[model samples]
Target: MKKPTPYTVSARLYDLISFEWPVYGAGRSTAISLLDLAPGSHVLDMGCGTGLNFPLLQRQIGPRGSITGVDASAQMLAQARQRADSAGWSNVTLIEADATAVNPAALTPHQRFDAAIATYALSLMPTWQTALLTMISATRPGGQIAVVDMRTPTGAAAVWTPLARLACRLGRSDIEAHPWSDMPQRLARVRSASVRGGHIQIRVGSVGRDGDSVPERDAALDPPRQR
Candidate 1:
């Protein structure tokens, strides 16, 4: 039998206990702003726990746009479904699968997305690099890919390191994962932001054209087509 994860066990209490407004929310908001999504754009949300990014994404994409959210935990996906239904967001699609291993074609059958994002979720996966590569492949050429994750607080915020570490540990995330580190190498025109005393890190970048090579391991994962 598969082991139950914290996400599965805490799906119901996630929003109230996740420290969204006080600490982590800034990171997601900043990444979405950097994406500069146009109205009607299609977006893929990897590791989209409980659809927390839905409200912000919907505001940018409007009613005509669509969101495909993927998560490994069925319990979490259930919560995400409820959130979408309550908001009456008919354009949201939720899928249950491991972000690192799921095929992009399975997420969007007709076309690649205009943008892809993962917020505070990648560090939990041991194969976060594969997840990052998947995000790049799921987007169209020149489309945006954003990753928002956690790390130890820096500078004056270093004083809060213990608390930050505690938060990440409780969530079963690795503060040292630094999943966004590869964004600069894989994507073009990379942009970044740090918030919550440096505990939150955000990176947004654009997918390269056809001649541009994605990492070798990702080559078999349905690389994005050139425009």
Candidate 2:
């Protein structure tokens, strides 16, 4: 297989990592771990590139629930649409729009979602804070927000930090791309963060209306793949 380019990396990695996290268990845990949503729940997926979480959500919510995937990248939206079509999923809708700029008028007035989710796209965002506030605004007051990203624990450049830097250096990417440092807390302030999980290095968190003492679970990023 040809190596994935930078522009194509987002779409290419969708399916590969989508089911790998296993949040608490396997794919089942990962899917449920995204949010504590009930059946027939309506969800808004922010920056929902290629709709990685769409399949699990679709299955969980059944035919009655609806999900709208909003992404700024047209290529990603196209890929997501293709994936949904291939899966014969009619409940998923892909829209070419920035998460931060979503207007209530864009969807039906009666289409307020029960929860919103963004997977791995948090760090990729430019203004992650504004993007999150937009996420908060898009949902109902008591709605839930599930966020996942490549998180780095705060510490001086330790062993793994240097290794991560070396990898980025060799790859000509930003070695100091510590994207999750303050973004999670910023998001948590907007909504109480609950059940934070992921490899300890790359954390994913779930934020909702009524959370006070959600525990952080350890998870590793770039886990060695199963042969």
Candidate 3:
């Protein structure tokens, strides 16, 4: 029998209990702002969960842009579908597949995305590096790729480490994963930000035409306000 993923069992109650508004939302918002997407762009939201990033993405991509959301949990995808439907967004597509193993070509045949983002999602997969590489593969050259994930709080915020670990444990994520650490080495012109006392890390970078480094200046965005 297949093991039940954390999201499969908690999809319905996720939004309410996942501490979205209070904690994690800032990371997604900060990452999207760095994406600098234009209208009519096609984006990939890997491990989309319940599509909490949908509204923010829609605001940037507008009605013309399309969103391809991939998640392993059918229940989570169902919620994401409902979110799109309720908002009357026809451009959102939800696919059930593992981010670590999904074929990029299957995601969008004959075309690549304008941008691909995985917000607070990668750490859940033990093979997060593979998933991040897949995200890079799925994006077009000169396109944007962003990742937002969590870690233990830092400095005075270290007091919250236990609570942060608890949250990560519940979500089946590794608080020590530090998935975004690999971004600078993989992508070009990498931009970064942190929020919630560094518990959340955001990285955005551009893909070179050769699928290597793009020769552009790297700058880090000012950290978003901690809540």
The whole-model lDDT of each prediction reads 0.86, 0.57, 0.90
- lDDT top scorer: 3
Identify the superior model by lDDT, candidate 1 or candidate 3.
3
lDDT of 1 by residue, 29-104 (tens): 7888878899999999999999999999999999999999999899999999999999999999988888888987
* Clash count list over all predictions: 0, 4, 0
Worst 10 residues of 2 by lDDT: 191-200
Lowest-sum lDDT 10-residue window in model 3: 215-224
Summed over model 1, clashes come to: 0
**lDDT by residue (tens digit), candidate 3, 1-227:** 76677877789999999998899999989999888799999999999999999999999999999999999999999999999999999999999999999988899887999999998899999999999988899999999999999989999999999999999998889988999887777788898889999899989999988876555748777764767
Badly placed stretches (over 4 Å) of model 3 are: 214-217, 224-226
Could you estimate the TM-score for every candidate?
Answer: 0.92, 0.64, 0.96
Q: Taking the tens digit of each residue's C-alpha lDDT, what string does model 2 give over 1-227?
A: 64333335556554564444533123223434546567798888888777777877886787888898888777678788898899988888777776656674474357567777766565555566666666656666556666655433234424355544443343334423444454355334222221223222233344434322233433433333222
Model 2 TM-score relative to the real fold: 0.64
Give the Cα-based TM-score of candidate 3 against the true structure. Answer: 0.96
Instruction: Please give the distance, in angstroms, between residue 208's alpha carbon in candidate 3 and its true position after superposition.
Output: 1.1
